[model samples]
Target chain A: MPVLEVDHLSKDFGKGRVVDDISFHVEAGEIVGLLGPNGAGKSTTIHMLLGFIDPTAGTIRIFGKSLRRNREDIFARLNMASPYAGFPNRLTVFENLMIYARLYGVAERAAKIRNLLGRLGIEELETKQMLELSFGEIARVRLAKAFLNDPQLLLLDEALGGLDPYAATLAKDVLTQLQREHGTAILYTSHNMVDVEEMCSRVIFLRRGRIIAMGGPTEVTRAILREDRKKPALSEAFIHASRGEPHAVE
Target chain B: MRLNRIAAVIERHVYDAKHNLERVTDTLYWPVMDIIVWGFLTLFLARHGNLRPGLISFLLGAAILWGMFRAFQRDLAVSFLAEVWSHNVIGLLATPLTLREYLSGLLAINLLKAIVGTAAAALVALLFYSYDFFPYLIALLPFIFVLMIFGLAVGILVTGLIVRYTTKIQSFTWSITGLIMPFSCVFYPVSALPGWMQPLALALPTTQAFEGLRQVVAGGGFSWERLWAGLALDGVYLLAAVASFDALFRSARVRGLLVRIE
Candidate 1:
């Protein structure tokens, strides 16, 4: 069975639907990229999957258990890391990690904090408060937090938003390693297509809250090129697809 | 299940506060300043007349209680506001951390701030003013417990307002808490108030705390009626605050206002 199964999930905001009927699946050890431009409902879909927002209709299951009924159980095995999620500013980096580790109910918190800090190459900066860290370090600390529980299913919402090219590449390698070594199923979101093309095994294209395309990145890119002579790059393919261009339908 | 979640949140706040020692001090600083400045000013004003030894002591005790209360309200409201201002609330929302967890964590932090602030005020009063610490110290725990609950209720109400309305209201919380004066009977005996003002002043939960503290410290016995009244009134306020928080959070989720800073 797939590690995650999202079935016809829909969420409405006020009078309009922000995340329309959407469905997908992720097998263990698979890295899936949720790609979309701003306001494409990528975050909304992720939020619903994480049980942050209730769906207007449909079901989501993790490890074959219903998310609605077993959210705490599912959440115990799952974790999300994003720099955008606020950490207490006055707390030191060590303190921030320790707090999350405890919340995730990680045993032997001291060792866990030390191991994760070392893993993230942030051991030296442990004592520094969060406000003192550079943006890149903060991003890396968030990444550390996500994997703190040794999560089986990791949802990374714009996980690499602030990293430089080298750091972003290192993060990608870490994600790849996490999957290969631990069988972690990752749902990655990013605007950077090159990273998506390199890191993801499969791609899900969202346009105004609907999944427009899903397949291997190479296969989708090739198909888009074959169908649209005007656009050559995957970025252009994304815009063309979102605009309801006729070529994207195929 | 509900209790488990609440405990999880409380644990998170304890952890956060433990690592962030600077924040605890930062939270208590302004309130400490309020005590130093206002405590002296009230003394100076009352010195010209008969400063009832018991009344003056009551005023000092009320200042200490009020300081802790403001410390809690300001700290919790500002902590939540800081998250909102920095645009990080949305990020926390995406995690397994529920709204209740977030609110509970902040509330715990506020409670801790009240304890620390009260302690600091007592220490300072002891060292600087040659004040008798025994009665004040004995009354400290119960006084702070009631005052913290009252402060938390105000904090939740203010936080709910901040989430739904503009952040401009955040500044008003401290000023209004300071303004809870005449009703609290911080400066004079409740009996000294005009006939009609007596019931009105006595209705405030903090007034009961002031009266009870004086009865215990100077009058030589604990006032059961005042203690129970304070707890009951403050309990109702806390329930109202929690209800308002629930409503605000539900509307915020629908309007997407919880994560919106401006």
Candidate 2:
């Protein structure tokens, strides 16, 4: 069974439809990239999935339970990291994670926090308060917190946006391993097409609240790469894709 | 509700308070300041020797109890504000933590702060004015308990507004209580209110609790009627507040109101 199943999801803000009818799912161990330019309703969709906002229409089922009926239980089995969310500023890294660990009822919280910080290559940052850390460091801390819960489904909503190249690569590798070893399904978003191309097995593209393309990375990339097979870079195709010239695929 | 999750949330905010100077001032500094200023007022009034018998006790006792009530309500609203201010609402409500568990955690922390704030205020009253605040508290425990519950009810209603409108309504936190204090009769009998407002004062649970406090201190014995009325009012107000808060919270999710002001 898929870890997440979203069907006919739509959201309307005032007279405008932000997330028009959409359907997608993520299977265990699958990494699906959700791509679009700003105002494509990507964040709204993530917010709906996170239960931060409610969908005006459609159903979302996670781990075989209806999201509307079983929100709290579903939240336990999934986690997300967004550059938008933050811990209390005065709290140390370890302190923030420790609270989340306890909230999730993770045993041996101190040890788990230490291990996750090490995995993200920031074990030395455990004692630093949020205000004392740079933006990149705070991003790393968010990733560590997301991974702390051993979530069955992980959502990344531009979670690595603030990271430098080296840190992003390291975090990406750690995320890949988490999926490979734990079979944790990930629905990811990023403006960095290179990272999405390298990490996502499949990609779902959204333009103005509709999925313009959905398939294996190469298949969708090729659909838009009609004239230039030489430039296999997903970024080049993304430029055409976001410009309102979309190519649909299976 | 899950105990562990609630415990964790309490731990989170307690840690937040330790590192936050503003929180320290809210929980301790302001409550103690109220007592110091009010205690001096009572002292100055007593020097004229025209004050009614047991009037100093009424004044000082009310100051300590009023401080506790205000501290409890302020802490509750401020804790919600803390989550809103830090943009940590996603980190919290998005977790396995049920809304009841989350609220329970908030209640626990404020309760702890009220207890600690009460103790500090009482200690200060003892050291500065030689006023034994604890004995009066022990004697008036039931009335005081009812008064604090009313405060919780008001706090819950205000916190619901914050959830619906975000911090735009935060002015209600400090201002609403100040507006209600006159009706509560914390410094005077319910009869002291203007004749037109006396009906309003009688309707408030705090007024009854305060009046009951005065009746007991005046050797008039316990007011079982006041205790029962206060409890009944608290139950209704609390239920209404909780239901309204639940509705507002659901509305916020639907309206995408929790989207910012992190």
Candidate 3:
């Protein structure tokens, strides 16, 4: 069974549809990329998957259970990280992690926190308050928080956007290692095609709340090239697709 | 509701208070100043023979009680506001923390603030006015509980509004108690209001609580009837507040406002 399944999901804001009939699934140990232009419903879809927003239609199943029916049960095994939200600024890095660890019911939380800090190479930042940390350091701490629960399925929405290159590389490496060692499934969203090509095993392209293409990196690139022969880079292909162009050769 | 999860949320606020000197001073300053000012004013009135005997006690008592009400209301509302100000609401809500656990955590923080504020006001009252509030402490229990319940109810409703509307209505969280003060009759008798407004004043838990306080301070026994009336009204208001909050939370989810609020 897939670790995450979203079937025919749609979200309408009354004035217009934000997410339209989107469907996908993520198997254990798989890394799926959700790429879209701004207002393509990327964040809205992530919010629905996290149960922060209710879908106007369709259903989400995490760990083979209906998300609406078993939200707490499913959320206990799922975690998300984003640059848009963060820990309290007044608390030290360690304090923030400890609080979330307790909330997630992680046993031997101290050791787990130490392990995550070591893995993220943020041990030196343990005593530093969130307000005292730089943007890149704060991003790393948030990533550490996402890993605190040893989540079975992870949702990362622009989690690496604000990090320095070195920190971004470390984050990708830790995520890759987590998937390899724990069979954790990840649904990642980003505009950086380099990271997507480097990490994602499969990519799903969204345009105006609908999946326009889905395949391996090379396969989607080939499809895009077959349709719009002038566009070479995957980034250009993304722009063409986002403009509602008829070049999606899926 | 999981106690551990609730405690974790409370611990977040405790850490904030411990690390931020401004937060500590903010919590302690107003209550102390209010008590000192009222304490001195009551003394001046007594010294000049311009006030009735025991007028100082009535004024100081009313000030302390009103401070307690304001503190409870502010703490509860500010706890919710803290999550929004720090942009932590989405992060915390995404966790396994249930709504009940989250509200319980806020209530715990409110309790902590109330204790501190009440103690500060009481100590200042004794030091400056030599008014012993402890003699009436037992009688004040029901009044305090009823007032806290009313405060929490208002806090919950205001939080729901702010969450639903985001920053557009955020100011309501800080000013809602003040908006209700006229109807509450906190510093006066319900009968003091115009006849047309008496019914509205009588409908508030604060009115009954103050009336009960005045009764005890005037050598009358504790008014169980008034206490029960206030408790009953608080129960109704609490139910309405919870229902409003639940509906607004659902609306926030449907509107995708929770994740977008900050």
The best candidate by lDDT is: 3
Tell me what TM-score chain A of model 3 achieves.
0.94
Task: State the lDDT of candidate 2 residue by residue for A1-250, as single tens digits.
Answer: 8988899999998899999999999998999999988998899999898877889998888898887688778888789988778888899998999999988889999999988888888999888898899989998999988988788899999998989888988899889888888899999999998888888888888888888778777766776655535434678778987777746554
Better of 1 and 2 by TM-score: 2
Candidate 1 lDDT tens digits, A76-173 = 78888754476767768887677666667678877888876776677898999888989888998888888877788999888898888877766777
Ranking of models by DockQ: 3, 2, 1
List runs of model 2 lying over 4 Å from the truth.
Answer: A225-232
Candidate 2 residue-wise lDDT, B29-130, digit = tens:
877898899888878888987678788778877887888888788788888888888788888877888878877898888888888887888898899988
What ranges in model 3 sit over 4 Å off?
A227-233
Colliding residue pairs in candidate 2: B87-B262
What's the count of clashing pairs in each model shown?
1, 1, 0
Q: In model 3, state the lDDT of residue B215.
A: 88
Q: Which CAPRI category fits model 2?
A: medium
Over all chains combined, what TM-score does candidate 1 have? 0.83
Q: List the candidates ranked by TM-score, beginning with the highest.
A: 2, 3, 1
